[model samples]
Target: MRFTPVVALAAFTASTTASVASDRYIVHFADAASARAATHASQFAPTERRLSDAPRHLRSLAAGGEVFELGPDEASRVSALPGVDAVEEDLMFEPTTVVASLWKRQWYMHDPKVGVDAEKAWKYTRGAGAVVAVLDTGITPHPEFDGQLLPGYDFISDAGAARDGDGRDADPTDMGNWSDPGECHSPEGKASTWHGTHMAGLIAARAGNRPGIVGLAPEAKLIPVRVLGRCGGRSSDIADAIVWASGGDVPGVPTLARRADVINLSMGTTGACGPLLRRAIEQARSRGSVIVTSAGNDQKNANTNTPANCPGVVSVAALGRDGAMASYSNFGNVTLAAPGGHIGDRGADDILSTWDIGKRGRERSVFGYRGGTSVAAPQVAALVALMRSADPDITVDQVTQQLVDNARPLPGPCPKGCGAGLMDAGATVDAVVEDRGRY
Candidate 1:
């Protein structure tokens, strides 16, 4: 009863200026001096010309490249000009063809070109026996996770941060994390977020259930490990949760019957990976868990963000519908990219997943859109689940290698480096299954 939808390929028609019949083109210059010389040359009419109806300047690249709207004949002339390295058409790219789903909002899951292509991977496995531990603000009960939830634990040490009036406990229910003005560091107040539930839904929300959205690995089990809370979470709590979630003992907390096949950490802070967190991640990886974490939302180098910067983890960066790195997503040192969606008009381009209605506390559940590297990490986590489901004996290194080897290049450029490329769930899972045949 998998919710397989008809895929719709978006057709794009290139348009030309009606007045001048011009198309966009980029002229790459050999050097900055050449670029400046071309601007003053009479043959090259730069967009800044005083003409009232002049060709538009689309963009100016920092590396002495100029994008302009030029007629085909004019483009040829520019290409033949001295000091011009090359002239190429400015091409337009969109997210891989979208799948028409029941909700129609899960574009990220269905985009086969730039997305993880979970739909294609589903033909092989739905991550049946894999377990994913979501370490975040915790989760709220929802219909999307009816039989997919595992007995999770609360690891928030501070009662105030937990907002549950207790220290550490077994209940991982998300007690609203609404904060007062200046409570956590910000001047304005913040809402509960329901961040964990959204991430869980991305990983394993049921597929054929009702009219709701489908997850990447619908059959994968989710263990909601509460670490973040009211303001945020502590490094110590997160470290302990990582160890316990991977079946390591955490003193009073009972050990998990099954270690998580994939550990999803969507939370992070600015600084080097602390010794405690790094050790915990190493321990989890040693136990055969594939750790996936967000590259952060600061749009800076990911090397400064904890857990993501730590070794032996897949630090993921976010991609928008245009197949480029999200404007707010961290770039350098990322393991790969995934559809994290973008802040579009009225939140049209954000990732669609399960969410709660309450602004300050738990209320009725609903489907909503959120955009960030936080949302991107879970998709890769689910992909790991699917890979494990395909070949249960695959080692953590093998899994990582398969992901890197099978990933396709981003449709656009990632100047700061986005690891291997974008994750291709179908190719990765297929490769794993094929490799299993060899053995």
Candidate 2:
């Protein structure tokens, strides 16, 4: 009906919201239209779950909280929870992370501490034991990923769950936009940007070769999951995608997808997040996926964004090239910082990276410039991939500590924002290997 950014989500920041119905209560719609709306709006697709008619009494309602994938049994229990009826799948993947100002080049991959070091990557770990799922636009067939792109399901389709039935899609091409950025375009059809592709490049763009650019983890593989389509995916779609990415099966999707060790979501709604997204994130973590999300770029504070504010997830704030907190970055509870660029008197002061040319609106190939906390998220994801590769048993806690403890702290506004400091890739890698010595 009407297009809104659906930002500054209330569900995400709020401690809790009133439940709509019992997790297991039979949803009773007052009329068919109401049920149809719930069905259509649901991410479950063709075969959705809903109440036939409105219940005589209200048992509970949904609130904002990233839900993780639940085993069929867990689903039942969640249904058994006070305010949960049919659990409409929600995508826990938040794809918008980074300072949009950094759409060009921000982080110094060459810095010794954070520098791009293939030699060291070879010496320590090549990221073989890990699987990273990039829930954003899409990925083109590229040499960098080295056929590491696993099979993924798309949630953008009305049929519910897009499958590459042809078994195609293993490319590493960049999808870009010029004026617009991100697959999460404004529904008004304003612009486009291949933000997701660019972020992946920074994380795992083929390394060791003297090609266009270098990545943080050359040996890591990315699971391309397109949750945010044209104008971005709805909360319901995101929730479903999250369950699927973390190795869960919805009612219709018979096959349980392979779970990801690390899930990177760069997107976010500006307002307090709705229950739609929060439950999915919570469920994914329950399934054992470390969600590394971007703190919103609303130019306000970090404590505001959905998915980012969800607990257990490692929320990252932004920093500038000057090595200070990026003016546009939201700070509070910030697990770590990366180059998300800064807001300037003129506009955005970005420390960017090479993005998919498509987002830049390129006619030729897929490499362009883009920025935002969306970009910063991948750098951290790549580092985690490396950590897992070094040690397959690496826990989420260890990976987080490596990023924070090894980060190069910058001048901060205080504990209110920016929990740790700036992220250093080289330092993160060294810390894991030196400390564990196991993997």
| Candidate 1 C-alpha lDDT tens digits along 331-388 | 8988998988875452757898999999998989988889999999999999999999
User: Alpha carbon lDDT of residue 208, candidate 1?
Assistant: 53
**Across residues 233-346, which tens digit of lDDT does each residue of candidate 2 receive?**
577767777787788775555343457888888988766656767788778877777889988777666667877877777887776655556666777766887766544432
lDDT measured at residue 422 in model 2 versus the true structure, 0 to 100: 69
lDDT of 1 at 159: 91
Q: Distance (Å) between predicted and true CA of 184, model 1?
A: 0.4
RMSD vs true structure, all candidates = 21.8, 26.9
TM-score of 1: 0.76
Q: For candidate 2, what is the TM-score?
A: 0.63
Model 1 collision count: 0
Worst 10 residues of 2 by lDDT: 4-13
Highest TM-score: give the candidate number.
1
Cα distance off (Å), candidate 1, residue 366: 0.3
